[model samples]
Target: MRAIQITEFGGPEVLRVVDLPEPVAQPGQLLVDVAAAGVNYADTHAVEDSYLSKSTLPMVPGGEVVGRTAEGRRVVALTDGGGYAQRALAWEAMAHEVPEEITDGQALALVVQGLTAWHLLRTCARIAPGESVVVHAAAGGTGSLAVQLAKQFGVGRVIATASTKEKRELALELGADVAIEAAPDGAGLKEQLIEANDGNKVDAVLEMTGGPVFDASLAALAPFGRLVTYGMASREEPTAVTAAGLMGRSRAVVGFWLMHCVTRPGMYREPMAELFAMTADGRLKPQVGGVYPLTEAARAHTDLRARRTFGKLLLDPSR
Candidate 1:
């Protein structure tokens, strides 16, 4: 089997293609013939050993895959790791059969990015219809889905922020009521966010970019508003928050991690099925920005970290 291996912690340069033996499945695990692997922001972090959890050395760095079992059932599986290969292992419980109506890339997108978007809106933000919402990085994978889901859930106004003009346009096409530039270093950001909401603070925010973006998002929240922090793509720390400030405004700063939801039954499965149904019916569109061959894993990471791509990125192991 051909896989992308990282023997040392660094940047995308560390992801090297190597020929390795096939992995055998253990008890309660399934061996999958890899078709496509989902590349996520977390994978970039994992490769550099800077993720929420420590990454081991000499490892393959993919978390979600859409592939087949020995019995020929097409499924989307969440691997502990090692998804960037021609063959990989998955826990039987974690694998969900892919619907015939969904493409391999679509199924793979719904695993990590899809679930995170769903939980961030439904669980963490507790979003209510007719409320104003903000989705940062609106042209990216989770952001694109979050934008659509917010509208589906009946949000009054959806404000989307992206770094490029084309990205902002894509967000509007996905149903955002307003699209604005995500200025670097929070330059005029809070004002732009407030201006997008018709001179009013927003009701909820789905924030991932940390540092200045996070600070601006927090400042733009309305009274009793909730801001859900999921990822720090900027790799910069945000300003610290004190309980006093939150209490004064009756605001909340909640944190969410998809790994926590994966441990609890029904949390992941129910929403994933809903996402699949939505995608099948054409209500939700999973944007596959780019697909790279298995050997070009380094390029994929480079594009992702550099914000040179949009939507969900995939790796075709068969290539």
Candidate 2:
């Protein structure tokens, strides 16, 4: 089996393609022939040894894949690791049969980004209809889905922020009520959001970028507004939150991690089912940005980290 392995923690250059023995499925696991693998920020964090969970040296890096099982069932599975290979192991319970209408790449996107977007609004933030919301990085994988889903959930106003004009345009095309350029240092970001919402503070915010963006999002929240922080994509140190700062506005801040949801069976199952139904009915769509051969994993990471691409990046192991 061919796999991308990281022998040491470093940059995308450290991700090297190598031949490895195929893995066997343990009890309660299924061996899958990998067709497509999803490349995510979490994989980059693993390579840099910056994630909450550290990776062991000389390990194959990937967590989501769409492939066929020994029974020839087309399915999307969440792997513990080793998704960057021709073969990988998926827990039987975590595997979901892919619908005939969903492509392999779209299936791979749903496992991570799609589900995260669903939980961010439905569970973490408990968003309500008629509330105004802001989606950061609104043209990226999760953000793109978040913008569309926010509208489906009946948000009165959806404001999207992106670094580039093209990305902001993409967000608008995905159903955002308004799109604005994200400030480099997040200066005046709160004011921009307020102005986009017709001078009303947002009722909810989906924030991943930390540093000034995080602080500004907190400030932009209306009284009793909720902010869900999922990732620190900026790679900057997290800003400390003082209780007093939140108390005065009656604001709330919460954190979400997909890992926590996957470990709890009840948490991920229903939402995943909902996402698949939406995708099948055309209510939701996963945008695939780039498809790279397994050997070009390094280039995929380079483009993603540079923020030069939008939507989900996929690796075709069969190539």
Candidate 3:
């Protein structure tokens, strides 16, 4: 099997294609002929030794993958390493059924980004109809699905932010009522968002980028609003928010970590079924941004880090 191996923590060039021995499935795991592998920002972070628990050197990189399992059926997994290869092993518990009607490549897009979006809105926030919601990075993986789910759940209005004009338009196409340019200028971002809402405020905000953007996101919320902060894409270090910031506005600040949810599969089972049905019915759609042959994994990482693509990035390991 050929896999993408990271021997050091650095640039995309560190992802080397190497021919390696195939993995054998353990008692509760499957040896999958990987059809497609989901490439996430976390993959880049993992390669650079910035991930939560930096992986050991010379590890094959990929966390979430959509492929086959021991049961000989299509499924997705939150498995570690091994995914960026022609064949890999996955624990049975970590796999979710990938609808037979969906293509192998499409199945690859559903694992991480789609599930995170589904879980965050439906599980964490529990957004109600007639309420407002905003999804930052609405043109990217989780952001794109968050916009669609907000609409599907009957949220009154959705606001999205993107860094480029094309991305802004992409958000509107994905069901965001309003889409605006994301700014480094926190005050300007807040003002632009406020203006997009007819100067009204949102009932819920998905703040993926932490730091100043988190503060600006809070300012855009309505009283009693719920703000969910998940990623640290903006400022790598922590940012402080005073208790008064939440108390005076009657708002709540909560953190969402998908890894925690992954640890509790029982809690996510029912929702995974619903997501499968939705995807089968053409309701839960993932924008297919780009696909790269497994051997060219380095180029895939380069494209992602350069912000040169939108939607989901997939790896065709068999090719």
Clashing residue pairs in candidate 1 are none
For each candidate in turn, the TM-score is 0.99, 0.98, 0.94
- RMSD list, candidates in order: 0.8, 1.1, 1.8
lDDT score for candidate 1 against the true structure = 0.92
Say which candidate scores most in TM-score.
1
State residue 23's C-alpha deviation in candidate 1, in Å: 0.2
Give the Å shift of residue 165 in candidate 1.
1.1
User: Which regions of candidate 3 deviate over 4 angstroms?
Assistant: 69-71, 185-187, 238-240
State the lDDT of candidate 3 residue by residue for 43-103, as single tens digits: 8888888767668977999986777665578777777688898888888787877767877
lDDT at residue 40 of model 3 (Cα atoms): 89
lDDT score of residue 229 within candidate 3: 79
For residues 251-310, what per-residue lDDT tens digits would candidate 2 score against the true structure? 999999998888786777788888889989999878998899999999999998888889
Tens-digit lDDT track of model 1 for 32-125: 9999999999999998888999999889999999888999999999999999999999998899989999999898778888899999999999
lDDT of 2: 0.90
Best by lDDT: 1
lDDT scores of the candidates, listed in order: 0.92, 0.90, 0.81
